[model samples]
Target: MKGSFSISVQNNTVKYAFSLKRNITIIQGDSATGKTTLVDLIREYEQNGTDSGISLSCEKKCRVLEGNDWNSHLSLLKNCIIFIDEGNRFVESKEFASEVKKSDNYFVIVTREGLENLPYSIEEIYGIHTSGKYSDLKQVYHEFYKIYGNFNLENKIQKLITEDSNSGFDFFNSVSQKKYICESAGCKSNIYKKLLESGSENVLAIVDGAAFGSQMNLVSELLEKRKNLSLFVPESFEWIILKSGVVKDVEKILEHPEDFADSTEFFSWEQFFTKLLTEKTKGTYLKYSKQKLNPNYLSDSIKNKILNLDLLAFLQNSVQ
Candidate 1:
C-alpha cells in the first residue's frame, strides 16, 4: 500500500510517508496559488492508491455538471466523495447548495477562497503558495489565455474569483443597488395562465417594491391576486444599505420606517449618481448620528445579530 506523499519546494522532490484519512479538505488561497495543483495531486494519489486504504474510487467520485443533469450525478455519487472545483460557480443555486449540505459523504471542495458560512464541518483548510517568478507569471497567463481565449488581466482575475471554489470576498461592499423589476403585464398574465393550466396555486413573480409602497405592500398585492403565492426578496437590499451607508441606522429605520419612508425604500438612479457625495458626507453624518447617541450599544447589537443569524450565509443566500 502506498502512503501519503510530500513534495519538497527546494528540490521538487516527492516522498511518500503516511496516508490521509477520508476527510473533507479545502484548498484555499489567492489565484495561481497552486490550489488546483494540490487537488490534482490528491486525485492522482487516490487513483494510484497509497500505502493505506485511502484509495480513489473513480466509480464513486462524480463531477458536477451544469443544468438539471446534476440529479443524475448526485444519484451516482451519493455517500461517496464528490469533488467540486470552483464551488462558487454554483452559488446562484440555493437548491444546489442545500443538496451539498445534505450529503452524508465527504466532499473535497477546491476553491480560490474558503466557502463562508457553509454548514459542513471543515476538516482541513490548506493554503498553497507559489514562488512568484517571471516564468511562473508567463505560465499563468498562458494557461488562462488558452482556457478563456482572451488575455485581459483584470477580466481574467475577476473570472478566476468566480470560478474558484474557495475564493470570495468576506466583507460586504455595496457597489450597486438591487431593485426588483416587474415583468410586463402581458408576461405576468401569461405566467398566471401557465400556473392555472398546470393546476398550481402559486407562481413566483418579481415585482418592484418601490413602484408599490414597501416590500410589505408588494406582498399584500400578490396575496390579493394569487392565493398561496410566496415572494422572496433578495438580500441584495441589505447589501445596498450596507454599501450605501444605511446599515448604520438599519435598526432605527426598521423601527421607524415612516420617518425616512421616502428615502428608505428602493434606491433610485438619482441616488446612485449621488452615492459618492452621500456616502462621504451624508453617510458619515448618519453613521455618526446613531454612534454618537449610543456607540457601544449599537456595536453590540450588530455583533449579536451576526453571530445569531449566521450573517455571512444570510448575505450570500439573500443576494444570490
Candidate 2:
C-alpha cells in the first residue's frame, strides 16, 4: 500500500526502484528531477490494484493537505497513505511532526531536500537525479505529460533542448526563467489569492529566493499588490537585485525615504547584485545548462545561496 519510488541517474542511465512494504518512504531530489513523478507512479499503482493497500482501500484515496489541515489527515494515517509533494513545507512545525509520530499510518514524503531531523519513523529514503541522456529525457517528459494531462511551456522548452544540442545553454537559461513563470502562474497563484483575501496590510512572502525565474515573478506580483509587502529572498537573488530592470518598483520604494518607515534598512542593491553575478559567472560558464551541470555543484550553489541569505532575519523584520 505505502511505498517510495526513486530513479537513480548513473552513467547516463536512470535506474528506477520502489519499496515493497507499507512503510514511510522519503524521496529526495532537487527541483525538476522527478520526485513528484515517483509519488504519482506509486499512487497510480496502488489505485490500479498493482500495489498492496497499505493505508487506503483504493488508490484514489490519497489526499493533499496544507498548513493545519495536515493534522486532520493524520488520523487517516492508519488506513490511508499520504503523499506530501513538498515535505519540507511541514518540517518547521513541531506539532505536525509530533502528530506524525503518534500516527500508525504510512506516508511518502517527496522533497527537493531531505529532512533528517523529523521525528517520524521513516523506513527508507532514496535519492533521484536527473537523467543525462536524450532518450531518458524524452521518457521522463512523456511520463510527466501522462500525469499532468497536458504539456506546458516548460515541457515544450525542455523538449526544445532535447531536440537541439547546440541550443542547450541558451534554452536552459530561457527555460529556467520561463519555468519560474509557469510555476508562479500555477503554484504561487494560490498564495497570491490567499494574500488578497487575508486583509493583511503588511504581508511577508517567504520563498526559496535563489530559485530565480518564475519564483521572482511570484514575488513581483505580491509586491505590486501589497504596498507594505516585504520579500524574504535568498542571497543569490542579489543577481536580480543588481539587475537594474528586474525589480525597479521595489528598489524605488526602498530608496524613497517618504515611501517607507525610517527604520527600514536600505542598502546598495546594485553593489551586492553585481558581486553575485560576477562571482557566479566566474565560477560557471553561462552556457551551462542545469541538465549538463554537475549535481553537487548545482546543489551546493543553491544551498549556499539559501544559507547565506539570513532568511529568518528578513522574515522576522518583515512579518507583522
Best by lDDT: 2
Q: How far out, in Å, is residue 241 in model 1?
A: 36
User: C-alpha displacement of 204 in model 2, angstroms?
Assistant: 44
Q: Which ten-residue region of model 1 has the weakest summed lDDT?
A: 159-168
Q: Give the residue spans of candidate 2 off by over 4 A.
A: 1-17, 20-23, 40-68, 114-123, 129-320
lDDT, candidate 2, residue 178?
44
Q: By how many angstroms RMSD does model 2 differ from the true structure?
A: 19.9
Error of 1 at 310 (Å): 25
- lDDT tens per residue, model 2, 78-187: 54556777754775466765655555445557654434334211223445544543112221111211111222212222111111122222222333444321122122
Clashes of each: 15, 8
